[model samples]
Target: MEKEKAHESQNSKLTHENRFGLGSSEHVSIEHDPDDLWGDSRVIVNIGPTHPAMHGALRMVAKLNGETIESSYCQFGYTHRAKEKLGENRTYHQFVVYTDRLNYCSSLLNNVVYAMAVERLMGIEVPPRCTWIRMICCELARVIDHLICIGINAVDLGAFSYFLYGFHQREEAYTLIEKLCGARLTTSYTRIGGLMYDAPDGWEKEVKDWVVRTRKVIDEMDRLLTTNKIWCDRTQGVAIFTKEDCLSYSYSGPNARAAGIDIDLRRDQPCLFYRDVEFDVPIAKEGDVYARYRVRLEEIRQSLNIVAQCADKVKKGPIWSEDKRVKIPDKTLVHNTMEGMIHHFKFFMTGFDVPEGEAYTTFEAANGELGFYIVSKGAPRAHRMRIRGPSVYHYQGLDLMVRGEKIADLVAALGSINIIAGELDR
Candidate 1:
C-alpha cells in the first residue's frame, strides 16, 4: 500500500488529474436552467487529462448533444520529451537506446529505420545475413504491434475475451524477441553497420513454429470479431475518412490504406531484403473504423508470411559489414588481440564521424510510415534529427474524425489508428 501510494504521489506531481474521464483541476459548468433545457441543449463536456479514457497526460475536449459529439478538439504536448533534441546531442551509437522509446510497442522497427537513415548517410550496406535477420525482426515487431492494437481496441469496446486471446499471442511473440535480443520492449538491438549480434542457433525454426501457431490464433480472432454484429455496429461507418481526407491530413499506414491509399514503403520504395520477399499491402475502400480493423487483420497474416519466408532464407554468414569504423569486434577477438582491443575502445569512446551529409529513410511500420531524417556535419552527434511519426497526422485528424461520432465510437477509432503517445509527442 505504501509503495502504491508513493507511485501515485509521483504521478500526481506530474499531473494531478485522472478518473472517469475528468481532470482533477478542471470543473463542470452548467449554463441556464436544467429543466428548461432538458429536452434539447448542448453541454460542454470536458474529457480532461486525468480522465480514465484519456491518457493521464493527454485530453480530448468534445462538444456533445446528448450522447453524440457534434464537434471535437484535441489537446496535445502533454507528454513531450524533446526526443529529437536528445538525438542531436547524442552520438549515432548512443542514440540507438533512445529509438526504442519512440514507438515502444515496436521498438525494433524504430531501431532499424534510425540505423538505416544513418547507414544511408554513410553509404554502408550490411551483409546478406544481417539484412534477412533485420527483416525477421521487423516482421516480429509488426505482429506484436498489430496484436496489441487489435486486442486493446477490442477490450475498449467491451470485448474482454478477444483481448485476452490476442494478448496471449503477443506475449508468446515477446518471448521470441527476448531470445533474439536480451530485452523484449525498448530493444536497442540494431547498430549503425549491422545488428548487435547474429541470430542464435536454430532461431529460425522456433520462429517458424511461432509463425504457424500465430496464424491459427489470428484466424480464430478474425472469426470471433470480423463479422460479429456488436463489433460491426460499433465500428462500421464510424470515423469515416475519404482518400482526399487521408491525403489532406497526411495520413499513412493502415488508416490511409483503409481509405484506399496503396503506397507502402516496402513495395513502393523497397529496401533491405523487402524486394526479394513477397508480401501484400492490405487496402480497403470504406475508410471507416471497421475498414482500419480489417486492414490490420490482413497485415498480420502478411507479416507472418514474410517472417516465415525470411526464416527459410537466413543462413550462416557474417552478420556485420567489414566496415572497421562502424562494426564492433567480436569479444573473443578483443581479448586475444591488442589491435582489436584499441579499435573497440576508440569506437565507443570517440565514436565514428560521418562526412557532412543528410539522408531520409522511411519504413512501413506497424501503424504506418516511420521515417528518420539525419544530418551530419563531421560531428560525433547528428546536426539535426527528425522523426516522422504517423501519429502526428492521425492525431491531427482526430477532431475531424470524431465529429458527429458518439463518445463510445471515439475509443474504437483511436485504437484502430494505433496512436502511440511516445511517438506522437516526441
Candidate 2:
C-alpha cells in the first residue's frame, strides 16, 4: 500500500511525460491516489523492465486489487533510441538499419517498407522482379514473426512443445534469409530502388522446401495446443476487447482482426504485388487471447501460401532499376571503367537528392500498418520524419483490456499483441 502511494506521488509529478489513454486512443489524465484511501487489499506491482513475460524491454506499472488489476500504466522509454530522429538525421539509405531495430522479428519487412517510402519519394518504381522479391521477403518475415508470437504466447502459459516446434521452423526460414542477405536477424537486404541483389541461384527451391516443412510444424502445433483444455481455458475469454474498443484504440493487423475488424492494408490498400496474390485475412470475433492466437495461426498459413506463390512465379529478371540515382554500381565496372567509377563515387559521396516534397507510404507489416511519413527539401536526409508503428496503439489498449483481469492474463495479452518496445517507444 505504501509502495503504491509512493509511486502515485511520483507519477503525480511526471504526469505530463507519461499520459494514460482512456478505453479509447484519446489521452485523458488519470487521477493518482497518493494516499491508500481506497483499500489495503490492493497491491501495486511492477510487471517488467526486464522480465521474460515482457518479451524483453517492456515495463508496466499496475495497481492490482488482489490478483485482478485495477489500473495499469505502461512505461516504454527503456528501449527508446530516438529512431524517428535518426530517420531525419541520416540519409534514406542509412536509415534502413535503424528500421531493423523497430521490429526485430521482421526486419525484412521494415527494410522493404522504408525502401518503398524512399522509392516513392524519388518517383522510382522498382522492377517487377524487385517487387516480387520484396513480397517474398515480407511473407517470409511474416512467417517468422507469427511463429515467435504464437510460440512465445503458448510458452508463457506453460506449453513448451509449441515453442520448440515453432522455433525450429523459424530457424529454417532464417536459413533462407541468410542465403539472401548473408545475415539472419537484422537483415538490411534492401536498396531504395531494389534489393541488395537478385535471389541466389536455386534460392526459390530452398524456400519452397522450408515452406513445406513449416506447414507440417504448423499442423503439429494445431493438433498439440488448439484444442488443449488448459490453453483454451486460459485464453478463450480473457483480455477481450470489443470491436468498437478495437476501433477506438486504433488497433491494426492481427490485433484488429482478432476483434472482428477486417482492415488489412494488403487487401484494402494494396501496394507492390499484394493485389496480385490471393489470400484470406483471418479474423475472429472473440477478441480474446485465443482469437488472437487463431488469427495469427491462420495468417501464418496464408503467408505460407503467399510464399509458395512468390517462389513459383519468381522468374529471372533484373533486380535493380535503371535509375542510377540509388543504385550502387557493379564492382567490376567500378574498378575498370571511368564512367562507372565516377557514378559510384557520386552515388556514395553525394547521395541521390529527393525533390522538395513530402510523402507518406504505408506497408502492411507483420504487426500492422507500418507507415513512414517523410518531408524532404531535396536533401539526402529527410527534413522531417515520423513512423506510425502499430505497437503504440496496441500498448495504449493494454490498460483498458487488462483492467480487472488476472495477472497471468496480463502476460498472455502482452504476448498476444506482440509489442516490440523499439517500435513502441520510437
Candidate 3:
C-alpha cells in the first residue's frame, strides 16, 4: 500500500512538471539506478565569438539533440564601439569619418548618406558634376561590397576557387577607388556639399580600364560558379524567403530582389545622379542563397555599365559646390585675397548653420538600403543622427531563415543575409 502511494506521488509530480514545461523529457531523465540521475541530457554548444564560419565576433548558443539543432540564440556586441554615442558628441565633419567604421566593406555609401542628410538640412546643393561623381564612387563601392558577400558566401559553401577569383576582381576595383580618392578601405572622400577632392587627371581612363577588366572578371566568375552542379547543390534551394515574407520584414536590395520584389532605390526613388543614368536592376524569383548570388553577380555588370557612362559624362569642374556657406574657399585663393582668407578661416572654424529640421535619406548600398536620419537644431552639430543599416534588418530576419533548417544550412543562411556585425551592433 505504501509502495503504491509513493508511485502515485512520483507520477503526479512528473505530470505536474511536464504540464508546466519545467520537467519535460528534454530536461529530465529517468534512471533505474538513482545514482545516475545527474547525467547530462542536453547538448550545449558555443558557435563562436571567434569561429571561422561566424564572419565576425557573432556568437550563437545552440542547443542540440545529437546532430540536429533543437534551438539557437545569437549574441553580438563583441565588436561594438558605441558609434551612435560618438556621433552625438562629434561635429558633423568628425562624424563623417566615424561613419566609415559602420560597414567597412561599403564605407563610402555610409559617408555619402550621412553627408547628403546633413547637406539637405543645410539646403546645400551639390554641383551636377559632383553628384555624378558621388554616384560613380558609390556604384563602385557596391561592386566591391557585393564581391565580398558573394565570394565569402561561396567560400562558406566550399567553393574556395570562386572566393579567390572574386577577391582578385575586387582588388582591381579597390585599386581604381584608391587611385581616384587616395584612400582604400575607409574612404572618407565625400564631403558635406561635394567630394573631398577632384578626381585625379586621367581618372576617366583608369575607370574605363577597370570597367573593361571587371566585365571580364564577372564573366569568369559566372563561368566558375553559375552552373556548377556542386555550387547549385549547396545553395540552389537553401534559405528561401517568399516575397510577402520579405516585404513584411522590410527587406531591401538584392535580398528583397531575390524574392522577386522589384524595388531599387536607385531606380524607384532616384537620388544623386541615379536619375540621369540608365541601368537595369537584376532580380531573381527563388529568394535562395544561389538566387541572391546570381542577383549580385548581375549587379556587378550593371555597375560597370553605369561607371562606363559616368566616365564619358564626367566633366572637369569644381568638385565642391560654389556655395560659400558650405565650401571653404580654395587654399590658393585664400593666399591671394583677403576675402578668401577670412571666408576660409570662418568656414573652417564656425562651420555652416543648418536649419532646425529632420530628414531621412537612403542609398542603394551593396547589401541593401543604407539610410541616415538626421535632426538639426541650427547648429554645427546634429541634434540627433540615426542610421538604418541594412545589416541590422538582415540580422533580425535570420531566425526566420534558421529555424527548421539543418545545422549546416545555418551557415548558408548567414551567408545569404551577408550581415556585417559592425553595422548590426552599431
Model 1: residues with Cα > 4 Å off, grouped in runs: 1-40, 48-52
lDDT of 1: 0.86
In candidate 3, how many Å is residue 336 off? 5.9
Each model's lDDT comes to 0.86, 0.88, 0.83
Kindly report which residue pairs in candidate 2 clash with one another. none
Worst 10 residues of 3 by lDDT: 31-40
**Using lDDT as the measure, what is the rank order of every candidate, best first?**
2, 1, 3
Q: What lDDT score is found at residue 225 in candidate 2?
A: 94
Whichever of 1 and 2 has more TM-score, that candidate is 2
N/CA/C clash count, model 3 = 0
For model 3, what is the error of residue 419's alpha carbon versus the real structure, in angstroms, after optimal superposition?
Answer: 0.5
Best by lDDT: 2
TM-score, one value per model: 0.89, 0.90, 0.87
- Which candidate achieves the best TM-score against the true structure? 2
lDDT digits (tens) for residues 1-426 of candidate 3: 999976875776577566767685664554433322212345778888898888898988776554456678888899888877776677787787888888898888788888888888878888878887887888888888889999999888899998998889788878877886788998898888888888888988898888898898889999989999988998888878889889888899999999999999889888887777789999899998889999989998999999898888989777787776777678899999999998877776766677889998888888888888888887877788788888877877776766656678888888878889878888
